[model samples]
Target: MTQDAKIHHHVPDAAPPPPSSRWSHAVEAAGWLYVTGQLPTDPDRPEAALPPGIAEQAELCFANLARILAHAGYGFGDTVFVRIYLKEFARDFRAFNAVYARYFPDDGPLPSRTTVGVAALGRDALAEVDLVCFRQSGG
Candidate 1:
């Protein structure tokens, strides 16, 4: 198959991918969905002010990620990995995890994760998160 036939780009109507030609919100290839890092900006209103606190910012990031996942016909349960970037890692790690735990309950499968300290993120966001999900072909 050609590259176009093997890959699919996902862009939800509610949340346009960042204004750039270089990236998409999510891309599906060989039964895997890779979601780009999502920041705290509101998906419904990208221009609005970002959520102020780490917990709240983390919540928005997950919400944005969820939209991309669902748009590509995947869900949190399908996620196999996650990567988080925090502007204030030492101060906000616990609070960010508190909000993140809600999406991945202890009773259910939890994706492998890697979180790191970053000097900055787009929109001055306190947190940003990305996801990788396995999409069974022919689903």
Candidate 2:
């Protein structure tokens, strides 16, 4: 099979990839989907205001990621790894976990994750996240 057949770029229908942006929302190849970092920007209203506070920002990040996953035939259960960035780690870490756990709750398999404090983020977003999702060769 050709490489294009092996790797599928999943651009969420809900949010068209930015006209001149430099990334795909997700790319699937070799049973894995590598998702791009997601911000809390509204898909329908890219210019809308963002909610203030870590909890809300974290929730939005996940929400945005979930949409991309679905478009690629993946879900939280398919996530194998994640990376999180926060403008204020010390102040938002605990609150961010409280919100994050809802997706990978105690009953679900929590993906490996690393969170770091960042000096800044685009649009000054408080948090941003990205993930890798996998599906077994046949499953």
Candidate 3:
């Protein structure tokens, strides 16, 4: 069987920015979807101001991640890993955890995660997150 036969592949329906940068943003290969850094961009308005607090920003970040997973035919249950970048880890960690708990209650097979303080983020976002998920197959 060909590689494609061995494993189905899927790319998200979202498109990259028109003024292409060196980054590809996201890519899917061999049933795994790798999402790039997702900021707290409002679904209704991409340029909308991210809420001015860490808790709100974290929630929005998750919201953005959910959209990407949904578009790629996956869900939070399929997430295998995550990486988070915080502009102020010390000040925001508590609030971040509070918001995180709501989405990841019961520690449901928590995906591997890494979080670190960052000097900056795109558009002054306070927090950003990315994820990797395995798409379920129906035979």
The local distance difference test score of each candidate is: 0.84, 0.84, 0.74
Off by over 4 Å in 2: 2-20
The total number of steric clashes, by the backbone 3 Å criterion, in model 3 comes to 0
lDDT of 3 by residue, 1-139 (tens): 3335433223233333325444444566667778877787676676567789998889888887776677666778888888999999899988998887777676588888899999999879899988887764550
Cα deviation of 31 in candidate 1 (Å)? 1.0
Q: List the lowest-lDDT window of 10 residues for candidate 2.
A: 1-10
* Candidate 2 residue-wise lDDT, 44-85, digit = tens: 787778899899989888888888888888889998999999
Worst 10 residues of 3 by lDDT: 7-16
Tens digits of per-residue lDDT for model 1 on 39-130?
A: 88886787899878998898888888877877888899999999999999999999988998899989998999999999988889899898
Model 1 residue 7 CA deviation (Å) reads: 3.5
Q: Which candidate number maximizes lDDT? A: 2
Best-to-worst lDDT order = 2, 1, 3
Report, for all candidates in order, the number of backbone clashes: 0, 0, 0
Worst 10 residues of 1 by lDDT: 1-10
Question: What's the TM for model 2?
Answer: 0.89
